[model samples]
Target: MDIAAIKEQLPIREVLQHYNLYPDKQNRLRCPFHDDSTPSLQVYYKTQTAYCFSSNCATHGKSMDVIDFIMYLEKCSKHEAIEKAKTLIGGDNQLQRLTRQAVLTKMFSYFKNAVYNSKPAQEYLQARCIDYRQTEVGYNAGQFHHGTRKDEALIKSCIEHGLLNDVGNKSRTGDTAYNVFGKWCIVFALKDSSNHVSGLYFRSTLNNQDQRHFYLKDRSGLYPKYPATDTKKLILTESIIDAATLLQIPAIASQYSVLALYGTNGFTQEHQAAIQSLTQLEEIIFWLNADQPGAEATSKHAIALQSLYTKARISCVKMPQGEDINSMAQAHDNMDVFIDLLEQRTADFSFSIEKENNNAGEQQEKAKLFIERGAPKQPTKTPPPITTGELDSTNPYKLRYERDTVNYYIQGGLPKTTDNMKIMLVIEDKASTQKARNRIDLYEDKQVEKLCKEAGEKLSLPAATLQADLYRLTDLLEQLIEKQLQQARPPEQALPVLTAKEREALQQFASKPKLIKRLNELLGKAGIVGEERNRIFLLIIAISHKTADTLHALIQG
Candidate 1:
């Protein structure tokens, strides 16, 4: 069989229809050569060619290639494949015919009218919080009737420049408008490789109301549309509004191309394929919602496309807490903050195993003991002992006493004798003070023992001599305690009542600035005018007027 004759006799459409190998509304086909899960192979009726689009196995070729593929699948030679192709064509010439541009023009017009007049498409936009009129181009009722809405100014300008039909629209919905038969619909236009209007979408504006209402259109992948001359970068957002929001940023104003994904959940294989086909695309930034699902989808799509375009860098732009891009734009006129955030953005899912391992190693080292085992233990240092005078003079203790006494005096006061007794008991039994005193005594005992042992070992002296020194130190401690107690005792049998002279002197000391100045001068001369001495003197003055006996007892204490 002559190969050229066989090609002319092949019924492409009939074979496709017989095997259910027809392209969907988008002119896409499943790989007949392989068990493809999706329609990874596409047939362009206009070009009369087929191509495999799977990333794993992109085996694209012509009609002859298709015959060759069938031959291979059926385990037959080229002659057998030709015979099978003849049988599949069934002598149908209509199968080989392609639809003309006039049909596309008619389809676009029908859908555009359906979308503008359809209540369902209007409601869908409303439900999604999108206002068609608020977009860059105003809506045209007549254009809707014609199945295309071009920017009037853009069309007029292009027409003047002899560039007619240069403007077009890409529907958010996929290709289904070609089948819309008197259904409520929303429509958008499709553009060719030169960005000329090629198709239209007509979708149901009403949702969840009826099963028969559905329509969409796409003219994207076939277009060789170059971004505006000023566009050097591209920003991919989840919505058209979000894409507009990017243009609002001065940094990105004319420097980038902005495209909308329509929604987070609506990303399909066609969308991915469209994005992957952009040869001029250098970098793609996924500016999605700052939400869990949005982030997840962004990551998934970013990863999927990264393989298709190696230079593509993916980063997520998070909006302010609880605010979306629309709300943020309303709150702030400038996009400085948002742009800054984008510039500083990083891939949230990308991480380094080596860094994590280093962190773990550092933590393990931190957990190890600092000191080596079996080293001689260093002696614990003891704090300096507090003498009875210092204890009685301290501001903390004096303040405590004053506070209690003031409260007591206001409350008709505790008896003087009872107060003194309570003070003594507290000094002896309070846990902190008792602990401190015990530690001091234990340290002293250890020192004495150490001294005696050292003397016995070094001077060959009797341990009894060191024991005598320890005994003398103990006697001195006892004497100090006795003296403190003796001084604390009252002089009178029943504490002497305040005399008139004493009362006058106390009042004068408290009220006269001259007297206070003189007292301070005398205290300075005596080298006792510092904080500790002042506190001691103040305590003495505050409690001294109770009785001569109390004053003497306090001095001793």
Candidate 2:
């Protein structure tokens, strides 16, 4: 069989599954060629290609057709890769041909008309800064059309087209999947190379997490087409909304053809075919989320596209650290910086995908220990005392850490108060140089024991309890601090201090027997006695009794 025939026949997703090179819910994977802590490989099922977005790895931007995958995975020559793939694919099943394309187009047209007339869907696009009229937006009449509100014509047409699974609409009675058929949802038509409506995607206008995007089984793995008028530049985004937003930009609209992957993981063989069709396309830039996964994807896709289109320049336009393209577009003040960055062909910094990170390894171990020790059983607002460097309260370990500082971890559960148990993990350097693996306890290791005592004191919890369960103790302490923070006024707007003259004027009231009596009582509440409490009492009195002659005189003074 010809190599191209085999490539066409082999279901890349199945082949990837066969090799245990799988994508997650987000359709990301660690590049097999690199020791990636984060998944960097994006497998485009429709495109039948995989790209390692890890720029630091040798395979960075390396675009692999199924044959390239075989070449890389088997470390074989072209002929060998083809031969090995032949064994892997066996007799591969072909993609299910979409038979009702014409029907789908008609339904999409009706839905698109519905969306154009629907006030809410129009507002939804307007709110997203998308011009529905100009952008070819449609509506998905989600779980709303029922009883008298049902569009029988649409339903009958869909049934006629065999577009829906259940013929009589009996499934809509209660079947979760089938019941959703006639519901109103916003529709977006995905186009193929010939500008034919190859797919219809339905996205809910409301904030429903579970039902974000609804695609018919036949339409799966297709990219939403955007015009590639300037074949020299192509911009790929993670979502249709983002793609639409990018196209609205004057610079982007004039100089680029844009495509949306529908999802982070939705790049398909069909999209790859469309990309191959971009004969004059020289640059393919990824505009994805600026997160760990996004960064990895940007790198993976960039590398893949560069290799796939060796003649084309492949680079990434980095989104501002925490902003997505939509948010960035909305920020009128930030457009210049964003546009400047997007105009560039290379990234300032792409994370190291191939480097073996000891910190990541240690954090993974600590997370294992945290979970094993029953984190859920003793839940805390503050995380476990795990450190992956940086004081991000977001990390699993809530332990405070300074770069290159010595931090200790205990083995087993909690040790007795000052029992001086052995330390299992020791973080010596901040960015790197993390060391951990069980070691014997030294009886003379008083320093770690002392740290425990200090922690107990700082936490205001009994030493025994704090030592017994670090996670629970931290939780209690964090809860208390959170409560206090909630009650306390912000420091910037704290009550004003009295001047020296006011203090002297208020000194006269200090001699009052009732004042002295109350001041002494407050000493107990304040956890102080004698001079310190006396001064605090005077200040308190001055703050509250501003109308008193002595206090007012003190304030005036």
Best by lDDT, which number? 2
Candidate 2 per-residue C-alpha lDDT over 1-557 given as tens digits, one digit per residue, 9 for 90 to 100: 88878777565664665565545434467888778899889876557788888887776767788888878777879999888777654333222222355446545644655664688888888767677766776776653235533444445445544445453344446632344552556667677655556767767788788777777656643444645544777888887778878766677677777888756666677777778877888777788876787776665565555547777766676544545677555433223434665764453222222434375564222111011221334545755654433332332212233323333332222222233332232223323444332233334335435544565454343445433333333343354446545666465767889999999878877876798567667666786655764565566666766554544324322
Worst 10 residues of 2 by lDDT: 365-374
Q: Estimate each model's TM-score.
A: 0.31, 0.42
Off by over 4 Å in 1: 1-192, 198-232, 244-253, 265-281, 321-341, 347-557
User: Residue 372: error of model 2 in Å?
Assistant: 43
* Model 2 RMSD in angstroms: 26.7
CA-only RMSD, every prediction? 36.1, 26.7
Q: Write the per-residue lDDT of candidate 1 for residues 453-551, one digit (tens) a residue.
A: 564454454456545533553444344445656778887678579999999987987787776566666667777757655555765676678866654
Question: What lDDT score goes with residue 223 in model 1?
Answer: 17
